[model samples]
Target: MAPTIPGFGYRRVPVADDVALNVAVAGSGSPIVLLHGFPQTHLMWRHVAADLAADHTVICPDLRGYGASDKPSETDGTAYAKRTMAADIIALAHALGHERFALAGHDRGALVAIRAALDHPEAITHLASLDVLPTLDMWDVMHGTGAAVGFHLYLMAQPPGLPEQMIHATADAFFGHFLDVWTNNPQAIPAEIRAAYLSASRAAVPSIVADYRASAGIDVEHDRADRDAGNQLRMPVTVLQQDWGAALGFDAAALWNAWAPGLRHTTVSCGHFMAEEAPADVVKAIRDLLARC
Candidate 1:
């Protein structure tokens, strides 16, 4: 069962191809769509969304397979590709009667937002990605020892049956590991929230694995094509990421600059779960990003 939090209301709405999405929308003003990352749902944005909703109409949805959204089985691995997922968001925005809107995504959702800014440039007025790099760059930067920081990336990148079987066998541990490791303040994500994420992941194991699998395959191809085509995100882009440079020996800003032309990059001291770990800082970043736009 999804957690029922106050100051937010839930609704099931149709986006692309008549697919229904479980979205938590609140506040009222200019439209802003918030997309959550992997191993979690839109609830990750609960605090941030509420803060934004005080001034803007915030639309937080469980992207297709995560949270309470429709988890249709994938026919092909490409079905969960970021490009397809980005389209679902575009359709969601259109369904909400906004032809164009600002988009902010965290982790996996950041990849989707970047894809949306690339594929549907006109539809995304501004883009903000938290704690991630583009898929291709991410793959390129991974080395022998440095790659352990994202072991799950390779594990989930495996083909169909293997990853699904392995992950499902230890679903609680798989999901709980991130909940424990990714945040500076574990208490920020209470026992119930952690359990909620674990439950969602267990139910959507196949689709979740397929989503990551696509990152190693089709998602990389799309990024390569975009790079070859000289397709930089034309909109104003803001990125708040942990300083991976000093720790991981890669310049986060330099990597983001390749894909985002009008870019403003800042490194936050917080852990991977920036939205949950540092809601005030995240909200300030969003407000500043929107102000610049």
Candidate 2:
């Protein structure tokens, strides 16, 4: 049997005419949606989600084009854009009877959360982002040899054919690389969960690449437009991130502050996979974020 969050019930909900997200939901209070990041599934939130479910209606979903979710072909460039993905999230929340909810996401999911907050401000009562900067700041801060850390970003950002083929050929190594390098405590993920992440990622190569490609193109364009318009995240916002600013030559908080006037930024010592390696801290941060709202 596939791994699942303990005590959570699973279902598939239609977000668009052709798209449905695989969602794991539990608890029964004010809803809070948790979106999983790249190269993984909703299972990444097993630890945190279980904790939050004690007092909140915790909803964990594999974003479109990921995990067990539907992977629509990128027939048009807009198919995998964060804007489109964000809409799917909003629709999912509505379909689940949540007119508004608190939202949190890690890594690639953080990008989607950012877009959702910007596009549907009223639907997100509070927002938390884990370990990632907004798309515009991300591109701006990456420069020189330091940027080498994100070779995968550049690889998938390439136009179509080559990236998909290259990654597909060595899917395990490519996906496994992040799982291996991004966690401080290997046991936090366990042998089975790591295998599941690799298997899911290996099966979704093309759609995953399309997601990254959109970030490099349409996602950037949307962020730039929002910045130009002086639009900010109107909800109470919290950000937990590793201290990438010191090493990357930029202020992570300042970048987030530009987009979120009501913001609390924290620097954590954990690795990229903080949700798994430091789940208790992740839970505390989220609970504090909800308190603020």
Candidate 3:
């Protein structure tokens, strides 16, 4: 059987006609949905979700096109846009009987969470983003020699066919590379859970690439439009990140502050997989975000 968050009940929620997300839910009271990052599933939240579930209704879902969730064909650039994925998340919350809730996401999931908070401000009471910049700022900051670290972003951003074919040809190596390099505490991901993440990612290459491809195209466009319109996230926000700004040559707090007026920015000393590497810190950050909201 697949490894799962202990004590959490599972559900297959239909967020759209073509997409149904695999969700793990627990606890009660105010809801908070957690979206997983690239090369991972909702399982990444096992430690954090379990902790948050003590009081909040924790909803962790395998976002569309990853893990056990439905992967609709990426017929167009917009098909995998963060805007579209954000809609799926909103729909998932509505279907779960939540009209408004707190939201937190990591990596690619963070990008989607940012989009959701931007487009549906009324529905998100509190927001937390783990280890990523907003779409437009992400593209803007990723230039010069520093950008070399995100080679995969550019590789996957290419025209669909080659990126899909190349990644599919060596899926495990491709997915496992991130799992190995992006974690400060490798032991945080035990052998069994690591295997589960690898298997799930290996089976979802094309859709995953399409998801990244959208970031380079449609997602950026949407963010640019919002930026031009002077739109900002109208909710309490918490951003926990590695000191990527020191290496990447940007002020992480200033960037997030531009998008979120009510923001709390923190720099963690863990690797990209902070949710696993430093689950306690993540839980504290989230709990703090909830209190402020």
Model 1 lDDT tens row, 1-293 = 56855688888988766468898888888889999997899989988988999999899999988888887787866678999999999988898889999999998999899999999999988899999999999999988798998999999887678889998899999888988888888888888888889899889998888888889999999999999999899888999997666688888888889888899998888888889888899999899888875
Report the lDDT tens digits of candidate 2 across residue range 1-293. Answer: 77988899999999998999999999989999999898899999999999999999999999999999999999888989999999999999999999999999999999999999999998999999999999999999888999999999999999989999999999999999998888778888898998889889988999999999999999999999999999999999999998777888888999889999999999888888899989999999999999984
How high is each candidate's TM-score? 0.97, 0.99, 0.99
- In model 3, how many backbone clashes occur? 0
- Candidates, ranked, lDDT: 2, 3, 1
TM-score sort, best first: 2, 3, 1
lDDT of each: 0.88, 0.93, 0.93
lDDT value for candidate 3? Answer: 0.93
RMSD value for candidate 1: 1.1
Backbone clashes, each candidate = 0, 0, 0
The alpha-carbon deviation from the true structure for residue 126 of candidate 1, after best TM-score superposition, in angstroms, is 0.9
Off by over 4 Å in 2: none
